[model samples]
Target chain A: MSSGEAGWEERSVARIVPPIRPRKLAKVPFVELAEGRLQGVVSSGSSATRVYVSSIEAETHDFNCSTNNNRPCGGAQGSFHCKHLKALIDEAVKQYGLERVARYLKVEAAEGDDLHSLLNGKLVKAPAAVVFSRFLRHLTYLKVPAGSEPLPEMHWFPALKAVH
Target chain B: MQGVQLAELVQTPPGVDEAMEAVAGFDAALADGLSRLGPRHSEAVDALAGAVSASPLGAAAADACGELAVGSISDTELSALAGARAALLGAVHDALLARLDGALGRTRAEWEEHPADAQEPPANLLAGARSWLRELAIAGWRGVDEELVSAADQTLEALWAEPRLRRLAVLLDGLAAELRVSCPVATMERIPERRWADLWTRAVLLAHSGSWTGGAAAVSGRLLPLGVDVHEHGTAVQAQLHAVLEPRGDGPVRLVRAAVAAAKVDTIVGPEVWDLLSGHPTLLAAIAERRAVDIADMPLTADGDLLWDEERAKAGEPADPFATARVRLPDAEAPAVAPLDRHPVRIAEPVLVEGYKAKRDGTFDLGGAAIDVDADRLPPSGPLTPQLVNASTACIGLLRWDAGRWTLQPLAVRSVAKKQPVEAHNGDWALGPTDPKAAKALARSGSAVAVLTERAGKLLRK
Candidate 1:
């Protein structure tokens, strides 16, 4: 599509989901695991997607997508874009502005010992990614420890190289 | 002599003293009536009939005269005299009963020690209650006759009906149920009347204690979680605890024992309870001994210090409560503010002025610019127009540097008149200036801003 056409199309797509829809994702079950990683699940009827997001990196994530009458996507070859991933990304963008999410990704990719403090400071400005991940984690059925120190052997999201 | 006295006693006028005396004399006469009348039945009967004929209570006496006129004191005539004597005795007994009934006003302890000495059965409800309570205090629950038990049951039922007394009744009922399960009658018999009285007194005191704030006030602490069937009776449990736990002579021993019992039942009580229990030095020592036994497996010196001083070393620095107030050494100097190396300034660009402040003068600061706001650009009333206030994006403006000062001049303003950006879950954009109708459409769709934004961004790229 042409840039103007694309913009129009984008506007049309944005109109599809109400402003409240992304906010309602806050009600989703998710857990903040050890090292600040997140694990969650989202399902519609029998179709479900288990999402894992990285602790130190925002772009790095893996999802197990299963839909009716379709082969399950478990990061195998040709497993790229899925509706679940799109839903999660949409929620993150709406909850956090595009600019804020971009900044968060940049911050996460950069290496620093004071990353935790930095994340906390930046969270006030750009809370969408954290909130989105947390929402996802909340939707998950996995037992998550609360208020306790990080446990050893905590799992992290496997980096997927090919997801669009 | 008895027959003549009976004749004269029944012949007397009705006065308080005279009636009492006559009743007493009649009682003595009736006792010997049959025996005295064995040989002189007719003569005795004649004397009684003549006396009763002149008396106020003479119905029975008059009936006897008919039998005597026939030259015989028949069984029916004897029966009549017996009935008259009983009626007189009842009147006297009622007076005595009323006097005894006044004893109910005395304290329970006094009643227990000094019960009323009534010759006949109680003539009123209060009299009966006092008699029953007195007997109960001495003989325990076993001493409770059917009349007393029924009274007790009725009292419980009445209490159950009342809101205030219902709590005590419920607690008593719970205890009774528990007693039935654990020890039946055996354990209950061991509870003396004094203990029962004390329990009741304590319960009342506790119920009215008016919001006690002691350290161990977690009232249910371990009891609730362990499924320890605490009496759900309102406030009775606390009252019970106050009675049983608060006034123990050996406070610590009592507390530790309670703790031990709770521990045996797999309950971990809070520290406040221990503080109350261990308030005394002797109890503290006992607790210390028990705690020592608990931690005996750990490696420690005879003085109870850890074998390794690593924890003390790891403590790094001991914080003094009055550290700031401590005397400073002479070498210390006062703190100073650091000077900035350069003046803070930003290049000319279209920027969104998020906030503005009015200085002492009426001029406004447009994004930190110390310049006067154009009156024409200002709203008719209030500080700024709603269009400017509501705009999410920066209006096209030039940040100019003139005379070593920053000033902003607006070339054009962007108004979000048609579309208002809805805040997403993360306080981000639901709709932006790029999509004027996006917010309206998204609102119609009834989804979140974040979700719409993500999907729309993808659509734009596609």
Candidate 2:
């Protein structure tokens, strides 16, 4: 095709994509690897009032599952990675990608190991409040109405302002 | 005068520090002053005229202010006034920035802790970019109000609060200021409508620079030959070699992008990206060979992209990035603090979208987020379109907010290429090997006057 006649795929053939796609699903909407922990909010499958805040602390690998108000999860009593935390990782892989989740959690992957397999990190107790609040802050963005007018407060995040 | 000059020399020479220090207080003062104005009225117009008369502006401002005093101004005209005011401030910023730079005598202990800092592009590299227009005899905007050399104030203030963006915004302000001083007498018909759009984008890149420069680091990986993404910025064609860097060891996975920008000449720059890669044989050979290798001793910019200078690198063993099936790609993250819909930086967010289905509306939807294709920035018919056409698996690209929706300009595809499942692929097309086609496609965007390079020579000779 001629210049402007380029098809969509052929057109997008060159865009400065970020290193990779974010690896999280909508089920566990807000996940971030931050402050020595892999933490985020996993939406409640049954009750919206009791969304779970799950976290896995780096180095210690200490994991926690609780409500937004710090109530403990019955499924996460022991040192095992619970379903909520697993879901968080699953989405984290979608949002952040699997490799970054392993690196931040410092997982030494053997050949053909799922994120859970071949990992030697312990689970310990930590607060769920901060991660929950962070998720709440993240939710605020979805409320912003789309418009052509630019927001004065809206600029590229300094953190992502790579040379690219 | 000599005696006065000799007395107690205060080292106040507008250096980088002074320019940076001045930035902290201007926004608050601007906000305060704006608050005092309350609302725009007939009186407000007269007061603005008075302010323009009192300010150190040229004759054009007086003429525009006089016109505003006679009749009610429209919204665009009002914005023009604000833009010109902002531009005047930017001119001041430019003056201070230029004065402060290059005068520090190149010796500072607090900064430049690294010896490689010398290679850092001088802070004032493009600070005075507006000067180019005057030298080249190019026309610049003078605002709808006929206010001298204006940029949209709302657009400028949106970025003015950010120190990094502030540095750039101030320089842009100066750019408008420079234009005003250089050619202040443009007629009302000569002022283009929405002139600031091009200025906003051009000045953003020209004035601001990355924090990290002049440091070499080695990273080895299987360079997934994703694709070459290109953008036509003014007279320049910016092409990026987008790839996935699967580590030689257990290092974190990185999305590597090596950029090659060139001028768009009179002729077409062939259809393929392969011709662009021929300049750097190391990267081209590795991509063409399609093997795992050690890419060593490359300059790392602050934003984490390794500059591909066709120098110092080695080779390594093969490794698969998809062994784990899922990738938690490192850094350049989506704004965690805001929802994707409301995230301010969504305008510049880098996205890797997967599991997205093509909609009948000619858009792609991942879960619920809609992505339209930006048709302007695409390569000419030759390369790969990514996961859309084939197996429609996944793709790497940038996401930009345009019109009213998010537009996707994909760079690479991990789908079925040539009837085989390939992880990362650009396309089947490559430009000529440094021949006429290759030279046509690639011209350095960093070096200004992409279109005028040839035309300018003839203009100057006259």
lDDT of 1 by residue, A1-164 (tens): 11233222111011111111123432222222212222222334332332332122343433233322233434322324344444544444444344444444444423223322233211111123443443422222011111111100000000001111
lDDT of 1 at B145: 35
Model 2, B388: alpha-carbon shift in Å?
5.3
Candidate 2, B345-410: lDDT as tens digits:
223323455676766665556653455644334344234432243345665555453221335665
Backbone clash pairs in model 2 (N, Cα, C under 3 Å; residues 3+ apart or in different chains), count: 36
RMSD of every prediction: 42.3, 26.6
Best by TM-score: 2
Error of 1 at B159 (Å): 40
Q: Report fnat, model 2.
A: 0.01
lDDT of 1 by residue, B57-106 (tens): 48667766565455454434544554444344334333322222222111
True contacts kept of each: 0.01, 0.01
The CAPRI-style docking tier of model 2 reads incorrect
Worst 10 residues of 2 chain B by lDDT: B332-341
